[model samples]
Target: MVANTQMDADKVKIMGSKVKVDSIMKVADIEEAEKQKMKRKVDKILAYKPDVFINRQLVYNYPEQLLADAGVMVIEHADFDGMERLAAVLGAEILSTFDDPKSDVLGSCAGIEEIMIGEDKVIKFAGCQRNEACSIVLRGSGNHILDEAERSLHDAICVLVSAVKNHRTIYGGGNAEIRMSLAVHDLANTVEGKQALAIEAFSRALRQ
Candidate 1:
């Protein structure tokens, strides 16, 4: 994933808080510098030969066209949190700088595409590492509804991830609690004295 700041070539300014400085450069020189920086970033990304490029900020036409020409899918405006989630889902590393992107940092996906669901357009990544990636398209009548839906989906995903990592299952309707209570009760029966009474009480609480 390529997530870098895209500097505006037309907007060049020098400002400092504790110190003052004066510097001038030709417009062509400034623009050329920006283009060079962008080219370096693109080259670093292309070195990995990634199947998809996820940009944290909106990519200008130049970089977008460059990646497209190289036959790589591009996802623009993916915020920091979204990028982190994608990295986790794809089992990839987020390299702050592309100086040395080792083989371990690269991620793979079967394919990526832009799909329209309802009134919204979303990019979908398929066949991610361990099939861990998923995308949900929310449809709502208002902003409030959409916000609520997003929050709900986030909570659900958190629970799902926890369950997957733990590799433990517990049934609903208090069935697991009942089973625990029964096991504790059996253990209490095997013991003797006041400690047994305490264990019995604990098991009873679990039943409640």
Candidate 2:
């Protein structure tokens, strides 16, 4: 996966414009210049062999056709947050320029494919380096339900991150709680001050 962070077609066109005599340029010349500029950008991107391309802005048909020919999948108008998450999941560094694309900066995935989810077409990336990439497709009858589902998903992800960082997994059936409560109770008995009472209270709460 490689992303062209600069998705400004107008900027490329501006750079392609030539300053001619009498400040006049033929329409054909301008069009050809733009096409050449787009071709260069596309060629540079294709050289990276990115299985997927995430564009922040709309991609024109010309470049899209080129990518298709190269067997590269593209996701246009991707959100910034999505792109950041993708980079993390792929263990890939985001490069702003193709001037010197190192292997370390390129991301690889086992595969990418488009799948039909209901009436919509969804792109799925598989076997990323992190193996933690996920996509949530929400189906709701109304906007309110979708919004609520999104908020719930965000909260669930936060909890998952916290759990992963802690590197602890406890079994169900309150076994962990019982063990923690007992440990805390024992520690409280060793305390020499009134603070022990607070500790005991916490331990009891855990047991409950």
Candidate 3:
């Protein structure tokens, strides 16, 4: 996926690193040759009969058009992290070559479709092999609002994860503070010294 597919060959051996074309006719011939090579590469891919193809690198116009014409959804320039996670979620491997693609090496999902979200096109994958695979889409009128929402959501998720791992629970929304303050006040009443004054001060600070 991470190759310049528009080039004549994915791995080219330069005979003399500095060859110059003589005229416009030569340039045209070279371009035509590269186009034909790309056509062959695309044809090889079409023979696999894939419903969708995702590339971590660019898929230029020519090959992109060829795949589209063959009714294959081509998604190019996929982010590396997302691609890695997707491979794990779908129980598939990240392949460098398609010389011999097998059914077991391919990923599958129930469906993939494009949806519009706040003026942007987004691809949605449904019914993934991993039941835990999911996505959260946040929409807002402004970027700041969306950023704040994302931060809050991330914090909430972290809290839930911590609770699951630690198996601990505590009151939220200032209730814990009030309870601590009351407990500290009760302890201060049992003592008689400047330490009690300090404890009362600490409890008062927690109330504030």
Highest TM-score: give the candidate number: 3
Candidate 1: stretches off by over 4 Å = 2-25, 136-208
Superposed by TM-score, candidate 3 places the C-alpha of residue 119 at a distance from the truth, in angstroms, of 1.9
Tens digits of lDDT, candidate 3, 1-208: 2222332243334586865878989867777777788788887766667788787777777888888999988888777778877776666677666677466766778888899987888878777776545578888889999999999999999998899899878778999899999999999999999999999999999999
Across 73-164, the per-residue lDDT of candidate 1 in tens digits comes to 77777778778778877778866577776777877777777888877677777888855555567889999999999999899989988998
lDDT for residue 4 in candidate 2, whole number 0-100: 46
RMSD of each: 7.6, 7.2, 6.1
TM-score per candidate, chains pooled: 0.59, 0.61, 0.62
What is each predicted model's overall lDDT from 0 to 1? Answer: 0.75, 0.78, 0.76
Candidate 1: lDDT over CA atoms? 0.75
lDDT of 2 by residue, 1-208 (tens): 5464654452334465675545345656666677777779888888777777777667778888888899877788767777777887788876667777566777777877889988988777788878556677899999999999999999999988989899877779999999999999999999978899999999999999
Residue-level lDDT for 11 in candidate 1: 36
Please identify model 3 stretches exceeding 4 Å from their true place. Answer: 1-17, 23-25, 141-144, 163-208
For model 1, what is the alpha-carbon lDDT of residue 147? 99
The collision pairs in model 2 are none
